[model samples]
Target chain A: MSENTTASTSPGVPVEDPTPFGWLTTADHKRTGRLFIISSLAFLIMGVVLDLLVRLDLTSATKFVSLDADSFAQSFALSRETLVLLFLIPAFLGLAMYLVPLQIGASNLAFPRAATASFWIWKISAVVLIGAYLGNGGPYGGWANGVDLHLLALSGLVIALLLGAVTVATTVMTLRSPGLYMDKTPPFTWSALVTASMLVVSLPVLLGQIAILYIDHRYGRVFLLGNYGIWERIDWIHRTPQLFIYVVPVLGVAAEIVLAAAKRRVFEPLAMYFTIGLVGLFGFGAWTNFAITGEGADIIDGLEGVVLVALYAGALIATAGLLGLLGLAVIQNRKLPKISTSLLAAFAAGKLVLTGALVGLVGAAADWLEIAGRGNDGNPQLRMTTWVTGQQSVLIYGAGLLGLLAAIHWWAPKIWGRQLNELLGLLNFLVIGAGALLAFVGPALSGLLTEQPDFVYADPNATSLYSNWVDDTGAEGLSALGVAGTALLLAGAALLILNLFISICLKKGTEATEDPWSAQSPEWLLPSPPPIGETDELPMLTSGTPLLDAQEENEEANT
Target chain B: MSDITPTLASGRPQRPRTQLVATGFASAVCAMMMAGALGFYMARRHASGPHPGSDWLDGLAVPNPQFDYALLTLVASLVTAHWALWASRRRDTAHAWTAIATTIVLGLGFINMVMYSMNRMGLEIGSGEYQNLAFATTGLALAIVVLGLLYIGLMGLRSLGGSVGQRGSTSLGAAVFFWDFAALVWAVTWYTVYVVK
Candidate 1:
């Protein structure tokens, strides 16, 4: 654990300086991962900006900014789609692309070419998706061909994501360092494995959902009902337990911060593993589709309703387990861990995930209760309200982003060869933290306080999008929070974009000293800004914390 | 400190069957997609009742010989797919080429029969719920078949490029895995769409 072991920024070593064109065709995991990260972040900017617009529309409770209800709904749907697929999934996948191979001590992904293809496919499809939305053709879009294009693009995104998941999972399964058993992997890699496997099994169902919608819409719209019907079919992907898939990596990222930033391992690694795996299990949402009996009609019965209840309960239990693990870290450490920006992000992430799960459980149970003939009696009824959307946003936008920001800041040296400006990092975290709270939670509470539906709607009688609910007895306080939250989120995202530019492009700060944090993972062994073919060689690994073992042995030799 | 870069390094012990392992994952994804589509088909069929009159085919003739031929062609292709892998393992280039060629032909044959059956039935994709499911399921199966065929072609080239000795042809093995999965999908689809009905 000595600080003096820092490797100098030697002159002879080849730093990672791949040209721009090389990145387009390269199969190197590091380059591929960087592409996923940077592109996903760009999309994050767009996604949040679009979300802010949606929030404005909701705040005024009408099509105030986006022109018409169809346009507003389309933006709303596309923004949600972009947040999960383009922003959240790839951000972490990008992290995994960079870290998993390094963590597992693999030369490259299992299928390097496939990994390359996955990134490009996602990038192309995302662009096409944006085009489709702009063309007035998405789920609630007015144009027929545009809608078809959107569906096609969405399907391609799903395919790309699934392919990438396969590569990551296969790499972990077959290419781990000797003796680094699946159960013994580092927390972040473990999370990637679980998330990838979950996506592999679950995402294809979404593809199926989109395919049916595509054919139904493209060929004959008679059977598939209308826009609402199409949206409902894909609704389950964004709902509770199902949406928890995106949060699985957050727990992994947080746990890694605890060990690295805390400079100590957890008291019990297995419990943390169970926590990550459980969240992933909860996220297997292929079965949650709302497409059946053709339209608004659903057919939830004894076993199905019971299963939904169990899944929501499972998410709550997993979040609690995560909290307990973090508490264990605090109790085990001799002194409080350093208050780094990454750790702060980790704490915020835990809080957001907890709130998301709690709200999600309420909304899910309320929905299940109604479906199971128990009751729709949760004050204003949260089942089909903005509460559900708010719960997802908390996890996907709030916690998911924070956890990844924590990872990016913690591993900036490895990924970018420099540390992010700490002042900017902390401010970015604060803005995003506060923004997510007001933006998502505010609307979520509206579900209970007011009679709002899940998304923007065009009321026939009322001038605004919302109907009689706009006149409901309450201060417009919650809607104001939504607007404020969006503003904060957009600003927060911009702040991140700025931090990345200053830290990466401007080459802020000196080259990172090896083991700058004195972290004890195998990856920290490689030169900061690792070289072409990783380490020339590594000693056989018999434990999860090989670097820690190496440190102990080095001290013994000195003594 | 003690050249403590003795920590850890990546790159497993020269993994020999990376292709086979990757193919298994890809096959699982393809299988799951089919399973999901089938779920929709089952639900719609259940709602329409066990016995929808003859018009369930969208006022067209029942797909008999063509559907039957498509199933038979896929069933026969599995053997050739296996043969290709077996031949590649033994370094029997002639047999490997023959087996791969035969499987490819069988795959093309299945696609041709499927198209002819749809054409004969004149099944309009937008006509009804069942027709929609039919087109969706059939199109999915066709995509799988085409993908498997391309994989076979790629693996065939790889085998030609490398001499498959004792470790066996990893690429060829993976190709067989996907081809088998394609056949399995056709089996399920045939049973669900034609035989059971």
Candidate 2:
């Protein structure tokens, strides 16, 4: 247990170098992790700002940012900022691949060289993607463009993936003390493993396809074009299996976070086995829908692709079972000895459940619409589905915004080592969530109306986007509620930015020396500023709570 | 601290053989599905009298001059393996260093052939149906080749520590023999298919 054992920065090693160039080139995980978190926050703010502008524009067709039919078309077009942000999320996700291992008690990643390569690849790809935005072709077209970048950017991603996958697998295999076996690993680490496996299996196929596309773009070759057509090219290998590639690990991360924050374990270990099984099976199944129905195919066929639709339905049902465990957790939180910080996390987990359930409900409804042959032309279910899918301005701007807010708050401490003021934190949540929820309500209800009402003729300007609700209320109470909600949401969103900036500036310096939550994981076993190499002696663990265990060990040694 | 002998380095943990087997089977199945696609490509080329090379496979096309290259690559692989064994037996640093470098070069050259062969086939991204499949399969092949490169690098690192002493060196030699044997079998299969047919 001597501090001089290993995994320590040489005492002579400076924490942060004085020279600007040296500072910039340092690959020290702590420094990189900080940069990653800060960059992610910047992206978050940019996304939220653009979203609010788009929402306000939607609320009134002739608002300051006009939304005429042609304008709508232009709005949907990929622009410079849009492309940058689009690439940024995965870049941050890649960054997580670097930072998370260090946070989880490993010295260096499993493959240091590959880890370095992954970062360069992502950074270079970002430059290329952003450069393409300024180019005349408008950065390829549609999701295909995303794939195009995937091809150019894949070598780095593969490098990152290998390093990441090895780090996770090795941590599971070798890094842990003899006592911390498969069953006893912390929830977050468990999630990391699942995410790692998905990386190994899923991303490779996607990268392969993208690499093919990149070659086609560079040369005159037509991998997905010509007599056979692009969809057929995809359908041949993974007609329906591709969706799980993106979603399986997302669900894994979500499940683990929800359980840990909620202070609950998964209802059954076997449940995860089912979850991964279904993910792999349905991942293949989900992609097939795209094949039969075709990508960007009609809403009806998208709704109807039975096998894909059914798999999604089954997934939703299983997720609901998982959510039920979470719900029980919220109730259980009432009994647990709740510290202020843990309470903040617990509250965020509570909102996560509600948001997740709504997402599932929206998806199920979309599936039912396809099954019933009712689509956006007349059916509400179909309209809702179309809205919630990534394309809809409302769903993307709304649901994703809220999810980002929740995730930011949950990870805020680990990222920065400081807590937001409790009051401001609550205020931040209310404003962000309420803004997105109101936007969702206004657009969704406006969408349901289908035809412009006679009342619009009476007073066209008065009949805003939520005119139906106003008309339903006979021009009085509900319209007032809608307006009030809109005002609250918008003002709240603006306040959120101000609040975060202040929080960042005012953050307590000394707290940076403490692991924020008294984290029960290996991450907190080291000093607040972890040593460059890592801790000297591997921290011992009796239960799953290594940090807590370390504290007791220190006390015993002193006694 | 006393000449700080490295802590008894952890043994290579056993993988759930079941998971490994499952992934291996899945990978094998996928590879076959792709190989079956080669038949369609060959058939189309036969019927049409000429076929455009796939974009992904363009990287794999070894030039005619490189015919001897594969053989030389195999010899280097064997020499490196033999050197590793010799070094381990003699406890010689030079033997370890030589073996590690040669093996890496051989692995890189082999990987380059895979790239050249695929690129030559024009199995570029977005190439129509058959070509896309070819690109994906070729990419998988490159990934495997990359793993071999990684193995050689790991061996080099372990060798420096003298941990990859005689036993490790012998195992690596055995591995090289197996790889060369496989390469011969592949050469035989290629001649049987293209020349005989």
Candidate 3:
């Protein structure tokens, strides 16, 4: 038997043998999870800095910082890549890596060595990718381009993602504790399973595309002009379909947080699961929607048309089903607790997901209208504009980031054995929410007027009869709004980080109880910062709300 | 707080068998998905336009016969590697050792044949699109095969030290599974690139 010590008082102190070199070789999921969180946060900061630079450059028509075209493209590409690949997705996966075992009452991940290797591989690949930026002006091939160093960096990132997918998937599949059946698994773990499964299926296409791109770049430019449609097809599949992979797990987070906050069992657990499964299915099934944009609609005919329509219909139905599930959950809550930052953040995420879905419907409608020859000639370009960027921002950054924030807040007690400052948490949530709204909405509004983002620079000497709506006053104002929103977003991120540092490192917050939030999940039945050993036994789960059920039994015994 | 001695019941410790099976399953799934991606790409390319003709494949500078032989050697390696695993599971030490050695030799032969084929082709990666696909598919398979060989070789050394036996059979089994997967991937690549056209 190990002695119990208040982890909050001695945060970061290893409960087990504190060997000096243990950090290097530790396969402890908790420690690995922390490493992932800290590293991904660092990448997030770097990405935010690059984003601010891009926003600053977009502030005026003339280059604010005067970067060369290649440099500008590289910075933009790197920023988007870093945020998506290195930050958002990894951060969610890291949280899952840490929390899933606990939620399922497992001692450790399924493949601890593989989990460790995955972390190191991801970290090393991120370093290599950033290093590639220093070589050859840092991948000027735009976000999805197949240029030389960029292709290499993309491949490295893809390999890292695949490793992570394998580790997380295998862990969720194989490491559940006794009596925790698949149907009774916590929402977050369920989401992680779906996300990992999707990654296994979808990411290989990305890897294959990049492999082809690398080869084309190495040999002759076979794909440079002649085979560009092929590249575009693959890239679209890789990019758009994979967005759900990032968003879906966060949706699970939102569901968990909401259920925890409302202190109620989910309205229809099976229905929710079914909807989530559909989300994953349609996520990949909708690949053709992206593939058939622009000239592809005309080029692809016959059987492809039938496939595209079926996919489109599937995506629409899945989106509707998910929305209905969310709405039902919200309406069926037994009692709402006082608003916490975590709850607010979860709500914000849910709203953002809904907004993204609505925007997607509009985009789909535009595509359909264009295909029907009932819209303007440039409808395809319009559909491909910053409107798409806005939709992504709503889903990935707004929904994804906020949902993660909600999880961090909801699980911080379990993670660090202390509470983040409530005042700071609320402030951060409000600021980030406002920032997300401003940032995404501005671009969406601008996209309504222009066929492409205004950030793309044209030579000053070139004159055309067509008006450049992107550089006009309206677009400029929107760009400025986006920059302002980014500033607020950075401030919120800083505040959240500071709050976490103070709570955990400085030990200023009150010590967390086992069930700090009165949560219903099984993890809350364990000690805060669960004991680090092979003998730590979790109470057998008898229901989805195992902890609540146990508490009810104890109350009955007392009565 | 009460002086409660925390009875740390570290949730279920994973069985070695579970780890082996889990890892093997993951590897098989990943390899199959990779093969599927390759097939999807090939199908799309074929559907896009007229076949570029046999001249296109020949122009890419891939020595089809040598590549085919290398794939055969890879398949042989897989067979011997799995045979070693089977023997180790049954505690047939001498037979397992002999089979592993044969597997290593065949793996080396495969690598040599691939190198010779590439040399005969006398083409850089940048020669053409077909060359690009051919190299990427073959190169990826080759890398996986080499990694499997290295792992199996290390296991062989461990066996010599008398540390690996029934207790370490799971490790040997996983290695066999991985090598078998690599071989299957090679077969896919061979058929897709060398034989399909």
The superposed Cα distance between candidate 3 and the true structure at residue B188, in angstroms, equals: 1.7
Tens-digit lDDT track of model 3 for B1-197: 11111222443444556546555645654574455447545754565433555355545455778887888788777788888888887878888889999999999999899888877877567665566666777777777778788878877667644855665677887677777777877787777766773
Model 3 clashing-pair count: 9
The candidate that wins on TM-score is 1
Q: What is the lDDT, from 0 to 100, of the residue B17 in candidate 2?
A: 30
lDDT of 2 by residue, A308-417 (tens): 45655565555455456555655665665333432443344334333433443344455454432446563334323213322232223333334344444445554455
Ranking by DockQ: 1, 3, 2
Pairs with backbone N, CA or C atoms under 3 Å apart (clashes), candidate 1 = A105-B10, A105-B11, A106-B11
Interface RMSD in angstroms for candidate 2: 9.2
Worst window of 10 by summed lDDT in candidate 1 chain A: A1-10
Q: For candidate 2, give the DockQ.
A: 0.13
Q: Cα lDDT for residue A450, model 1?
A: 73
Q: What interface RMSD does every candidate have?
A: 3.0, 9.2, 4.8
Provide the TM-score for each candidate, comma-separated: 0.91, 0.64, 0.85
Shift in Å, residue A93, candidate 1: 0.4
Clash list (residue pairs), candidate 3 = A219-B126, A534-B10, A535-B8, A535-B9, A535-B10, A536-B8, A536-B9, A536-B10, A537-B9
lDDT of 1 by residue, A90-128 (tens): 999989988888787776788777888999999999989
> Model 2: residues >4 Å from true position, as ranges?
A1-23, A48-104, A139-173, A221-306, A330-372, A375-385, A388-414, A438-500, A508-519, A522-526, A529-533, A546-559, B1-163, B166-197
